[model samples]
Target: MKSKIGIIIGREFNERVRKKSFIITTLLTPLLMLGLLVAPMLLSTYSGDEQKKIAVVDDSNIIGAHLQSTDEINFIETELPIEIARKEHLEEFAILHIGKDIMSNPSDIRLYTNSTASITMEMNIATQVKMVIENIKLQQQDIENLPAIIASIQTEVNMQSFANDTSEDSGDKANSSIVATVIAYLLSFILYMFILLYGSMVMQSVIEEKNSRVLEVMVSSVRPMEMMMGKILGVASVALLQIAIWLVIILGAGYFIIPELIPDEVAMAVAMLQQGASPETLNTDTDMSLLQAIATLTDVGYLAKIVVSLVVFMTGGFLLYAALFAAVGSAVDTPQDAQQLQTPITIPIILSLFVMLSVINDPGSDLAFWFSMIPLTSPIVMMARIPYDIPTWEILVSLGILVATFIATAWAAGKIYRTGILMHGSKPSFKELWKWLRFK
Candidate 1:
């Protein structure tokens, strides 16, 4: 029985890996994901380099001079009226007017642009105006050594955090979140694609064997349970191989290419740090020691505990659903009939994704905890919650439920497959399926 299962699994794996579709999809998916990860950074850099010209119609020279020297802004003096500027499509020109109360109220300066200013441009203008006001006040007080006093007065706060009775830097939180989000997304998407890919492969294999009447010959050699297990294991092995290859590619890219290809924003942030700017000010805070943090979070001696837990849950989740798909395929005479049954299975996955998004906003919510505990939703939901730190007992309980579901579903699915594979030509109803399940 073991040897027969092994042979079947080997055949299934060989057939799937040799297919061109599997090869192409496996290679293309990671590259596409990498592109998506980097696209926003590339676009932002391109936009930042594009010069935006602005015209200053400063009735009082105070606001205009201050706005001119601000970063990333090229300000030009404009004597033209605001109405004329608008009529001429003057995005290249804008007006800055000091109201009649400028002497007593310098804040009464109005900026008139044909269009709204970019966020960076607006921030730069505000900063420059604030600096000018500070300088004016200092001069009014006849203060000397103002620059030294300002430099000395700027206080930097160093914040730290504690988790699991150990000190942790506050900077670790952002990095941890990113790592968790990336891992959760990767695991969830993999589960999703594999179930669709391998489950369809299982269904198609069953249909082809049934159509060619080869299943009858095979059944004489192997038990129905063995045949089903072999098919699932074989396809699963193929999926595992593809996943292994992807991991290798990702790890290689992270070590070899990612540093070189770091986005300009990230690079600029690093440069700022080299020049003594605080990480909070520059906003490039991905420098957390993820390896250390993961170790701390698990409190387990090995990383394999979390890894094994994820694999077990995912495998159970995949097989549980795959068995249903196989049963559906067996009961149907054609692919069209199989597709109709797919909607019910698909709805849970779609709902799981929506729930995962909600987890990002509120990981500690009761909704998240309950969703992660339910076997049907647990695989994806629990994987998402891992990054946010779930209790060890919860993980164990979820895994236990998932494994039990897989066993029960596989047994029931085998019953359906055994009857449906040999008896075809009509779609089976729920009542007929129950009858098939009871058949000796």
Candidate 2:
């Protein structure tokens, strides 16, 4: 019996793994993720290089001199009238018109452009004019060195945060909640997608085989329960393999790329700390939050724990949901027919994703704890809390519940699949399915 199940598992596994779509997807997914990460930075770097010139027809006359050129914009003062400047400087990006309100009415300023201007461009013109007017008013008050006084008093504060608890290694170090949230969100979303993607794959495969009468041939020599388990486990192995490959590629790239991002002085400061130098001896301006974020991600122990938890939860979650999907597929003759039956199974998965957002903000909240404990929602909710260093006992309990739930679900699904796999030409109601479950 075991050998027969193993054959089905091997056959299902090899059939998908050998497909060109699988091979292409496995190779391209990491590259696509890398592109998503790097594209914004590259665009920001090159987007501001070309400056747009604006012809200034400042009726107030004093404001034009204060207008400065930035990487994205250039202000050129024009002696021509506003109407003439609009026509003559049509080649320019825009014409800035500052009213001769001479002392008040800041609303009189306007920007006329040859073409439609971006909000950024309009904001830039308004900001420069406003600053110039304010400075002029301050100077007219006859205060001594007012500009210098304001400049001297200008200050900026960058706050650093640290966790209160000192028991764990992460507790003593500075923490970046932004970085933690991003990581948590990414992990949870990936887990959610994996379960849905692979679970649906199992359903679709079952439906396709049933439609083609392939399952009829196989069931002659195999039990429905064995066939269902074999297909679920087979697709699970394929999902895990794909994830393993993605982790290797992403981690390998991060290892090489992260060091290049660190400045030489910062790298030296990190080395100094490792060599027994005190934190005070290093550069005071070093961004501790960024450093800590980098250190947290690269920590071998933390990474291993996360990876292990991901595999465990992903497997358990996929199995719990896939069994229902397989059972639904077996009961229906077509893909459209299966949709109506799959709604009950899909609701928990969708609800879990929405609840994960709140869990990220307050991982220790009662809402998070309860959701993470429930087997149906635990996989995503628990992963969101893991990055915050939740208690180990909670994780163990959650895993235990998830495992027990999967076993019970698979058992129930097996009963349904046994009868439904042979049924044809009719759709089963909820009452009918319940009767099939009790078939002696």
Candidate 3:
């Protein structure tokens, strides 16, 4: 029986992995995800690269001298009438209008744009005007140390957090907690995407086999349970293989590819992040410690715990859902039928995803505790909590429950698959399914 299942597994794995669609999708998915992560940074960096000209209608000219040009926005003094400046051929994004009585009432100053400008554009204008106004007000008040006082206004705070779990582990808790939280959310999200994707793959594979009229011949050679498990294991293996490839590529890019593309300072920061350097260690005077905070997140024990838990949950959830989806595919003749039956099977996962998202905010909450214990939701909810201070006993209990649940679920699904895989003339009603489960 083991040999038969292994042969079936090998056959299924090879058949699917060799397909052009599978190969292309497997290789390209990581690049697409990398693009998603990198595209935003690139856009923000070059978003305002094309400098926008601002028409300065400074009648009083008190603020015109202080106005300056930045890489994002450039101010140009315009003697043209307000109406004429509005139609300036220089492609100005906005006009900074200063009334003749601007100093007594700064409210008379206004910024006009062709259309409603972005909040970012408005804020840039406000910042420049505020600086000029401050200097003017300071000059009128005869303040000598204005520059010194203004520099000290936005004081930097070097805040550090410590974990209260154990006194012996008392260093800065800032690094571990933050890094763990990020890993927990990201891993759980990845699990969710994989389960949804490959779970449906298992179901579709079964349906395609049945629809082609080869399910009967296949059944004659292998037991329905063996066939079902083999299919699940094949798809599961494929999913894991793709994930491993993506992880390697992404990690390699972060370490090697990205550094070469970015500036020296950014490359240095990325290197620091990879090496686990804390921000406080880099510069005492500067509060830029976010990269160094990631250093403590590389705790060997913490990473091992997450990896072990991730593998278990990913396996448990896939096995549990794969069986259910196989049954769904067997009961229906078409993709439409399979999707109709999928609503019940998908509800728990959907509900868990939404609830777990909220649980991520407060992993120690009562809702999170109970949800993490429920086998259906545990893979997602428990993962969200793994980054926080979860007890070992709780994780053990959850795994035990999930294992038991998957066994029961697979057995029930096997019964359904055994009957539905061969029954195909018409759609089976809910009553017929109940009888199939009771068949001896």
**Top model by TM-score, which number?**
2
Off by over 4 Å in 3: 1-3, 100-109, 134-144, 167-182, 252-288, 297-300
Model 1 agreement with the true structure over 366-431: per-residue lDDT tens digits: 988888888777777887777555577888888888888888988998998899889868877778
- Candidate 2 wrongly placed segments (more than 4 Å): 1-3, 138-152, 169-171, 268-281
TM-score of model number 3: 0.85
Clashing pairs in 1: none
Question: Candidates 1 and 2: which is better by lDDT?
Answer: 2
> How well is each residue in 1-440 modelled by candidate 3, as lDDT tens digits?
44478888898889888999989988898878778987999998898688888889988878887888888889889899777887773467788898887778868888888666889888887888888887788778977787788798967675545445564433334445566667777888988887888999999988899989778998988899999998999888887777777766766565566446555664465456445445545533323445434444434455567767877888888888888899888899988877668888899888888877888888888999999999988888888888775887998899899989999988988999999999887888778887888898
Q: Rate the local accuracy (lDDT) of all candidates.
A: 0.70, 0.85, 0.79
Question: Where is the poorest 10-residue window by lDDT in model 2?
Answer: 270-279
lDDT of 2 by residue, 331-406 (tens): 8889888888998988999999999999998999999999999999999999998877778899999999999999
List pairs with backbone clashes in candidate 3: 276-295, 277-292, 278-292, 279-289, 279-292
RMSD of 2: 2.7
Per model, state how many residue pairs clash: 0, 0, 5
